[model samples]
Target chain A: MKRILSIMGFVFAMGSITSLLIIGMDALTFERILANEQALFQSKVLDAFDVPYTTATINEVFIQNVEAIELDVNGETVTVYRDPKTGRISMEISGGGVWGPIIGVLTLEPDFVTIANVAILQQEETPGLGGRITEPAYLAKYIGVVFNPDVVVTKNIPSADNEVDAITGATGTSTRFQIILNDTHAKLFPLLQALEN
Target chain B: MNRFWKRLQYTKWFNISKDGIFKENPIVVAVLGICSALAVTNRVENAIAMGLAVMFVVTASSLVVSAIRNFIPSRVRMITYMVIISSFVILVQMFLEAFFPVIAASLGAYLGLIVTNCIVMGRAEAFAVKNPLKYTFFDGVANSLGYMWILIAVAFFREILAFGTLLNFRVMPDTWVNWTVMALAPGGFFVLALIIWGVREWAKYFDVAAE
Candidate 1:
């Protein structure tokens, strides 16, 4: 009985020590991690705007045009997007992929007829398949895609509705991304019209 | 100190290489690490970077684990090994973030997934758990070389057909059409299966006679 108790005590002590070490390391690196993520997001946002500068330098370039907004989605306020120069609203769309999540920021021109930029925030689709959608080839496809009242993804390019080339062998991911794009347009189109009127 | 020095030079280097490359290969024979193998091999450059990173982590983790083996109680050996391994992984992550941010960005969370790689864990549990510090460290290094060579070969094939390049260096003539499917996950599965088949045949032909 004594031997067993002693073994258990040793195990508990080791566990405590290991846990404390991990916790301490995490605490030390927590701030750095957050700063890195913030910088990444800012860079992506600037990239979407085609601002030819680092996120740090973007402040000097477009100090007045872009403004970050929080959107109330089903009673939850999420950081939708920013428009640093014009105070124009941007919509942040979140969607699900076959394996994980895919979220992006779609900055719209005030007219709502064209997309200013699209930047992927997160993705975990199968690499080389669905993951290719996150590449510049696919992301570039979103730029200038018309955000009309009935925006939809279609394989046939130059169609009346919004059509971006679907990544071959990754139709599911393309379809999923289209669903989120349409949903965001549906909600924001009416809001923009009301605001304009 | 004298006995330690003697042990450091005790194991023959050629014997170590033979064991790691053929007898106990971490990838082909042991099947230890396939996660990052599949994820990064789509691009040969990424595969090379990941292989070198794994080599560094596996060697360093083995050295540390072997050094602390005596102090680690049997009841909590696994956690002790994990803590040591995670530390090395974080260090590798920081190094990559600082120097090769592009590769770092491409690898994404898969870099962190190195902690869960069976190769690192297997080395710690199987070899480092019993061997002396010196032999264990060398063993770790040798095993990593075996893994690196296999990954580079596999990635070479996958990247050339998939992307028409080797290590991002274009190989195929520009006029030739590339196979896009070779760059996808299915391509990785296909290529790995063929590699395993070839290695199996080689092993059979090279089977040693009774000593």
Candidate 2:
């Protein structure tokens, strides 16, 4: 009876120690983990447009310059000044992707047809499939292509400036990419054109 | 304190290491942890991450089990192992999520499933409970490494054929006709079967790892 009691006491003591160790580790790492996630979000958004910023720098910029807001189904409106260095009014047009969603900040050079930058915010797609749409191979196709309001998934090249190839197995994802891009351009370009006056 | 020191000497480090890789080969003989083998083995990077996660969980759990072996009830041994294993598993998940969020997300539900892996429970019950503290630690490390190598073997074939890459390093040229079929889960079973066959042959040559 003494031996059994001793064994039980030993097990209970050890269990408490293990639990304490696990809880200690979790408490120590929790804050850094949350910060890393937020930093990742900013980096992905900036990468979509070809804007260069490290994780730390991205957080610094987003905290001061960017604003987050929810929108109805059409999309959210993000407005950035043309010269962030000097204030000039401009608008960001954003929308969804097929598998999940994406928000792009579309900016134009002085000429309405020319693109300054486009930063995509969110995407959740099948990796190596729909996910490849964000790669330079796909996104570069959109770089100089003029945004058309009536964009459709087309096999035949519309023309160099107007067409982009759909990702082979991920046509739905590409189609969503085009739709969001076109809607942003269609609504925002005219508004910017009016603002120019 | 003197009793603790004496107990530590009996753990038998050499036997613990040899047993994990040979006597109780987790994948070959025990046939445990096959789920991650199928899912993560599709890519070498994913395989490595899964292996590391398992290693961390296994080593941590074994140590905790050893440290607490005496108090656990014989009737509730499995429950005790589960609690210890799950704590480490959760810790692994949180670490992966914090540092390597992409890999963590890719692993998805399988990360949580590590707690239920039979090899971990087997080690705790068969060895850690009977052994001293230090030897149990080595057993956990060796078993996890052995399991990791098998996973890498499966990943090597699947990743090369499916994506024409090894651990995300480009190998096959762009024009190479990639095998889409290799990327699917069915390919993992095929690769695992081939590995098992190879291990059996090697074991036969050396007269090792028999039953």
Candidate 3:
């Protein structure tokens, strides 16, 4: 009985101490971590829009150059950023990848049919395989690709303007990514078109 | 001078450090914590950051475990180590995310996964629980440095061969073409295996059962 009580007491003490430590750390870092995440997201948007800004000036540049449009699509609030200078549009798109959710930024030309850039904000995929989606070189392949009707990620040589090469060994991620892009574009393109007028 | 050297060698802390860093290296000899070793050794900068992070975690957690060793119950010992290690890991994660966001992002899931690194738990259970606080500190730092040096060595070759760069600087000539395969998982396996074999051979550490 004494041994069991000691074990229980130890477990309780250990749990409480560790929990308090973690809670203290989280409280200390909460604001800075949030700011860092916001800065990263803003920097990605600035890159897509071709606006040059240093880390110190990211917030200021974003505020001055980009306009955020809050739109209601089926009662869901989807916020998209637009470059006032070029009329290009950028929005966050997310979907289920093989291992976990893949979230990225998709930028479009003023026509809303051609891709300007694609930058991954967050991804949890197979490293060196599906994870290659986060590579700038891989994402660059999306640049200049047309979403006429819809985009297709193919394994074979990309003959059509709407087709981009899938990651060499990551067909599953590529297919899911294709669906994510098409679905997001279908949802947002019309709303953007209406706003242009 | 010779007597002093011999006496130092015989000291508990000195021997503990020697065993942790060289005689029983976490990677080369014991072969613990290979997952993050393989995953993050692709870049020199990454290896450095990971090494520092692991160093902090192992040292801090081991010290904590050692400090509270007497009060811990055997049945709940493993759970205690886990909680302590995880709390430290979260602290490290928060610190990095707040100040060194790039490194944190580059490490990705691996940073949080430090809780699962066998080296941290292995040291806590094997050494920290039995040893005094001062000796445990030496063991912790020495073992983490052991892991760090190996990671840096692997990253050194991998980064140069893969990108023709060392820490993103162009070390190779303009004519050098990047070896794409060197950036992949197989490259990590080959390099790590070679390192393990080389270190073992040099140390004359042969598997007795195999022999």
lDDT of 3 at B45: 99
- The lowest-lDDT stretch of 10 consecutive residues in candidate 3 chain A is A5-14
State the displacement of the C-alpha of residue A79, model 1, in Å, after optimal TM-score superposition. 6.2
lDDT of 2 by residue, A1-197 (tens): 98678667756765796689778878878887788766765565444434567655888765565444322334755444444332222344455666566654555555555554555435676766887765665665555555544445566765655676778888777777777767766656665666557
The reply for model 2, stretches above 4 Å from the true place, is A1-23, A54-56, A60-197, B1-15, B173-175, B205-211
How far is B68's C-alpha from truth in model 3 (Å)? Answer: 1.5
Backbone clash count, each prediction separately:
8, 2, 0
Give the per-residue lDDT of model 1 (tens digit) for B1-211.
Answer: 9987677556576567667776667887877788777778878788888888988989988987788777677877887778778877887787676556678877888889999999898989998888898788778889888888788878898888877888678889998688887777778888887887788688763446899
Give each model a TM-score.
Answer: 0.74, 0.63, 0.95
DockQ of each: 0.27, 0.32, 0.89
Off by over 4 Å in 1: A24-32, A54-91, A95-99, A126-132, A136-150, A153-179, A182-197, B1-10, B71-101, B169-173, B189-211
lDDT of 2 by residue, B32-98 (tens): 8887888888899888999999999888888877886776777677878887888889888888877
Docking class of 3: high
lDDT of each: 0.76, 0.72, 0.93
Q: Model 2 clash pairs? A: A11-B71, A49-A118
User: TM-score of each model's B chain?
Assistant: 0.89, 0.88, 0.97
